[model samples]
Target chain A: MVRPVNPPASWWRSGLAVLVVLGMLPVIGNIFRNDSSVSRCEWDGQVMRPEAAVTLELAGRSVTCCDVRCARNWLASHSERPTLIQVRDEHGGDPIDSADAFFVRSAVVTNRANGNRWHVFGDRETALRHARESRGRLMRGDEHPFAGVRGLE
Target chain B: MIVNAYAILSLFVCGLQCAVAVWLTGRWLNSRRAWSSGWTDDGAEVVERNAYLMMTLALVLLGLDLASWPLLYLLLQSYVPSWPGVMCIDGVTRIGTGSLGASRFLPGLLVTLQVFKPLVMLIGGAWLVIYLANRATSKAPLMRRLLWGLLLIGVTSLCDGVCTAGYLLIPKQEDHLAAGCCTQVTSTTTTRSSEPLLAGVSGTELTVVFMLLWAGLLFLLLDSIRKQRSGRKWMGGLLAITLVVAVLGGLFLVDVLSPALLQRPHHCPYDLVSELPESVIGIVLFMAGSFWVAAGAIASFCADVPETREILPGLQARVLFLGLFSYLGSFSLLSVQWCVL
Candidate 1:
């Protein structure tokens, strides 16, 4: 077993250890909560974690998502504390809390740029209100739906 | 192909080697003190034994690593026989791409490992000199011993720092700001207004400055040898001769080989044989410098004649000083200049 060479908790070593712990905060938060709704509203490489596969427990059912963005979308309707989540969000230093969010629902012209088909709602209303505002429109019947598992209890 | 892995491993081992050398030096001093007194213990003896074992291990590791190039060639012949697989001595790619600092593209992850190889060599060289200097004290004068010890520390550090910086600054392969070693002449639209003196200078000037410093050190080494006892002068003289030969070899390549042999007919538009080849002059200078360094290194390690004690230390110190000057100076000279019309 290796012991510390100069072992009275060397100030330099302690400082370095603290710095490393602080650096790990974002990464740990990401694994606990999928901040997808906020991410979709601000989609400029700041949105979802790139190509991350996550399993989130919403309400009583288990939902598997391609990424944090998908997880956030499913979590809006299904009321539950997210278990095993991944947070991908708000890169422009914008604080994207669930409260005080704007919702805009229009047939967003799908193009190569802004590639992900996301239900963006982080403007003027909470996510739930935004979902209700869009009720029974292009987002109605599941025809060619977003490529992911949906509606976890 | 897998040179990156080899380089990283070598660097890690080099750190271990440096630590071992320091430990051994401490142990040797302790043992000498014990032996001087009447009381003696097996502990000192054990330390001495361990030191020698460590030294031997370090040498064997270096030798094995150096042998890898040949070993790869042999393996290739037995396995997938291809034209490219067979390594050519002349066209062998210089280690590490220099794109880390020189270009828009992100440097390859593996290229970073290239910086460590030269560092390992510098440490290894210094370690060898120190080990030899310790053993040669009986035959060397005080000055000679001191010089060797000083040189070992100074030269190694200089080489390590300079080579690291050069590889980072000057891309090994052809870059957009293409300078060192790659100059293709295309057009000859000579601008008459450019500073004539600065115009002649190129990236190769670093090599020239290095060569000049080395030559000066070589001369000092020769004078030190001349002062040594009658029989020991021959060793110093021989070393001086070897130094001269090596310098000449480098000069011949830079001056005669590159211009007379390597230069092809006009291909690129920017090409112009504007002043006498500055690179050739630089090569000759560096060659002279390398010769002196090698000579000093050998003499410090080998000579132990009765009257040469003082001379050994001085020679060692000169070697160390010159080694550093050449290594860093060469890189600096190359970094600041480039191919132009």
Candidate 2:
């Protein structure tokens, strides 16, 4: 029977270096890839669309949510209330303070999986128009969508 | 039952493994009986034939088993499109859960098989290393022990076959069940269950600990390579410590590194794999490194046997070096990700 011979130490070292370099190739490519423009919701890690984006300050950091329902759900789960809450106006697509915005629970669902139905608008007329068109109800700015719902509160 | 080319191939490989395992088991028993009866040199040729046949079939089964690990994921990924709301492999895993009128057996078996596949591969790889070392000897002194090892591998492969077949063959309902994906189920926050293990350690701190452990393991492996005879003394201890480090490494990866890699606060390993496909290289390197370390340790233990002592040291050195290379490669790749990201 022939004995198996071990390769030279230098050979092993060279192989190691080559393998390490090969392993880093993809990582190097990743560094150059532009993924910064894509924004994902903080709550569910879903990609956030510009039109339906909601922003809230949690723990001194701005957290983006996909819609009003996610933002509310996030706030309800955390012990500390958000210092600032902002939602994008559906008509103009500009961020507006949640307090100044009119929320319409439209029949049109924004996010089906999370059951998001409320649409935020800077103008009451647009909110009423959306409510009428979609057969939705206007919710007060201070109203909690999940309030009194079991386990959500 | 998402029938696709990958699923068909997996089932075929699994079936072949099952058939080979049964054949090998029968051969092993016959050989054991022959050895027990103390047949003289007249039966040496028969024994040699049996050993050759069994070893050949076992190696093939081992290759098939190793291939099945990757194939399992491919099969799952293929099923993703068929299942609504199933965006990732995690969703495909839930298919068994939502199957109409199906017992919990299918999902439970899938999980069990997932856990077992790696273990089977590790053990089988270690056995292959030992067999090679033994084969280098003129006398083939480790034949009896190798036979027992083969039997153990055969049993595992048989079980793997059964589990894979059950998972693949069991029909799943086409009804689209609203199964929660990894994003919904994987908790971003640290939970009570992990609190004790973490002991309030932050992700950065845990990463630091993990790096330090890897550094220590690499040093030990280097020392073992330099001093082969002395290395035998701590082989068992090294094995135990390595096992602990592996567990800690896995925890660090899933909880800390995965989120960091994916740039998501609430990311799971599935997300990391899906988003950063390159990270799979890091995972594979780490797993391969861990397996080499374990196999080296097992070989060292086997070297305690008088007949196999001569060739085991060289085999152990080579295996330990491989482990070092793999661990270093994985660490370097992860560091690059950490630094760049």
Candidate 3:
């Protein structure tokens, strides 16, 4: 086999110079953007949890969370009281509006590594119906203290 | 014509891909000494990483190229008439007219072939590189990788380019008279006011020419390989014969197997056009160019070299010639289509 080229730092500097001479391509060009926004749940700017009710708000936009872990982390850190409303979907683990939530009773809570609880509704029929019918997550009124709690009112 | 949104998007994607490749290559080069045995043969994994990165980047660009078909379909629906027989599928819906979609065995098969076309060149490049690398490690070096690579690129590029042209010219639909025969020959004198001398220049003819040119290129490639290996002349000869026969068989099969493919083209004007003189010139230019490429490929293959002389570069040159000719030939066939239909 042939010995690969192991050029010195000056070679890299020259390569960079050549690149600069060719012009900063990607940096100078417009990038392609897809129309449909399909961000992953874990990667999205939403918190995941089950017991505590907390809303995630960004500027004028707001979404709801189901757990205390979600409520604590999702709210604005600088403010004493969150001015925005947001909540997580109890069943699907997605963030949705707490006002429009439909929390189901007899929900099973699963433990997390971060001491957070993830609730799975015990009623398969209700969960299936909600999954099929609802566009977003549904949380019941008695699921958490902040389920019916008013924020930015 | 102005570049459409999709084309622009493709260009952007291509640029991004190239940028990512350059960046990734730079990073690999920097971290070469630290690479472990899982990735590279030695501590230096930069070259192997660069090759993979380059291939990935090229594949992405090719995807962008294939995406052009869907965008063109959309354009046809929105801007052009349906023309009744042709099928149209928007980006969301899957459309297949008997055998157009990926689900259908044939059209999907063709599309798949197209996707891997770049790899053919890339593989050849890798082979030449490896060959040179092995030789370089020897007590007496036989060939230089860069030289062989450049030569192959030059030759194969020519052949592939011509093949591409021929492919474009030859209508995908097996039938030549898809639009039906000329009902009226307009008596308008354009640039070239010559009588219809070329009668049998159908889509099938273009397809045959394409297949033949492709075969010739492949034959030359085999010849190059034969020169490298011992006792390979018989195998090379067999391949050459098979390729030629297959091309001929394809031409014959186009008419027999798919008779209903081409109905008589409607509004086909076999007119005395003075304006179409340039078209005749265009055909001549195409044929001449194809001939030149074929000649070069053949000549390169037959050229005798000393056992000590570097021959891979010469082989590479032949491949480039074949590529150029193939593309040019396809274009000519397309021009002929424009003339007839």
Candidate 4:
């Protein structure tokens, strides 16, 4: 018959307890570090600057994009039409409803990921002024960058 | 074949494991033969020596193999810079798809390795625990059983070594292909594939289901601990529950937590890991919890053998406690993150 031996020592149990406790230290530390202050683009996963951000309401959630191109591409892919589309004026940094905004596809790139050079302004005069200085053309209503995009139309 | 420090180290580890596994196989056969035939006085000493050597080597190799799983990902991550349009480890796996050569098979080989490595690690870890428990006894009555288990582990390790070598040595067409990154792959597939699993279940509803499964798992684990033994039926039920919980946990991470943490609307775990490294802790906790629960179930099952019955209960209780602690820790961490978000 096989004899039963005494139970093993408790060292491993203590070691495991220590490990479980140690695993929580980093998690505790992460709680204090806030990352929400910087807004990120939903389409390309890039940080969105206030001047270059394109915001839209899709499926009851606010979606932010790095530029007009990303916003258009995102809209083109999704079947649901956005309820609202808003862009920031390049000069004044004020939110402008995309319907009333003037677009300028300049040589200046706003987001490097997609090489998006499209700029938006709240008024036609500012758009024309920047277009002349940057040697760019002002886009008309039909020629707007997001004209063909499903939700933006 | 993009050569780097990580690749070189991985190849070296695999090679060493292969060699050790071969040596272990020889010792296992010898030990089995001696045990079955009933060794004489001097032969018994040799058998004992061989058993000790085999156990020591197997333990070390298993430990190394466990560590290699994470190292495999890190190695793939290192290759990202060499492959154009590859933003993360997901793209690195698709590095050589355009080529019509052995490199085209790289992704398949890596995927096989990914699946095989976890199975090998889980079995190897369970074997290690059993061996430790048996070793604590005087006569080591479980030696015969352990020898067979060791042989099984050895064969798997050898196969794993071969697969790892194949994955590393194959030359990848890095620059020409410019494989699509996670943005293209994960964005389209995650939502579509998860929809079937969700079955019209929203994220909030899934969270409730996940929490309920966790609660059930906790109850089963605590009951097992209280009884000081797990019935076979309960063990199977526990494993099933653990599997569902793990799957739902992964879905939760991909669909909800990852996007929320990254502040993006897409589902990509690679981005989450790359962007927020601390999230790895919660993942580790979840994985560890799952492993311990499985280990405890295996321990309880092993108690069926007459010789191990006396000692395995204590081991089972300890492992179950670990499982409970790990699961609770993971849940708490996720809760904290949800609150913060």
Task: Provide DockQ values for all models, in the order shown.
Answer: 0.01, 0.27, 0.01, 0.21
Top-scoring candidate (lDDT): 2
lDDT of 4 by residue, B1-341 (tens): 67999999999899898899899999988877776777787668767889889988788778767777877888887886774355566567766554556776787888888777877766775776677678778778767667777887888888888888888888774324334763232221112111223546777888788889889898888777666655678777888898899889888877777767765555666665556666667777788888888876775555346666766776777777778767877766666655655
Ranking by lDDT: 2, 4, 1, 3
Q: Each model's TM-score, in the order given? A: 0.29, 0.81, 0.24, 0.77
Task: State how far residue B293 of model 4 sits from its true place (Å).
Answer: 1.6
Candidate 2 deviant stretches above 4 angstroms: A1-7, A31-33, A36-38, A57-62, A73-86, A89-97, A104-137, A141-153, B40-43, B80-87, B91-100, B173-201, B229-232
**Which stretches in model 4 have alpha-carbon errors above 4 Å?**
A1-39, A47-63, A76-143, A148-153, B30-43, B97-99, B174-201
The candidate, 1 or 4, that scores higher on DockQ is: 4
Judge candidate 4 at residue B323 and give its lDDT: 82
Candidate 1: lDDT over CA atoms? 0.38
Docking class of 3: incorrect
Q: Which lDDT tens digits does candidate 1 get at residues B148-250?
A: 3433433343343343333234433333334456854321111111122233444266346545654555465444433422234544554565456554444
How far out, in Å, is residue B134 in model 2?
Answer: 0.6
Name the weakest run of 10 consecutive residues (lDDT summed) in model 1 chain A: A39-48
Most accurate candidate by DockQ: 2
Error of 1 at B222 (Å): 3.1
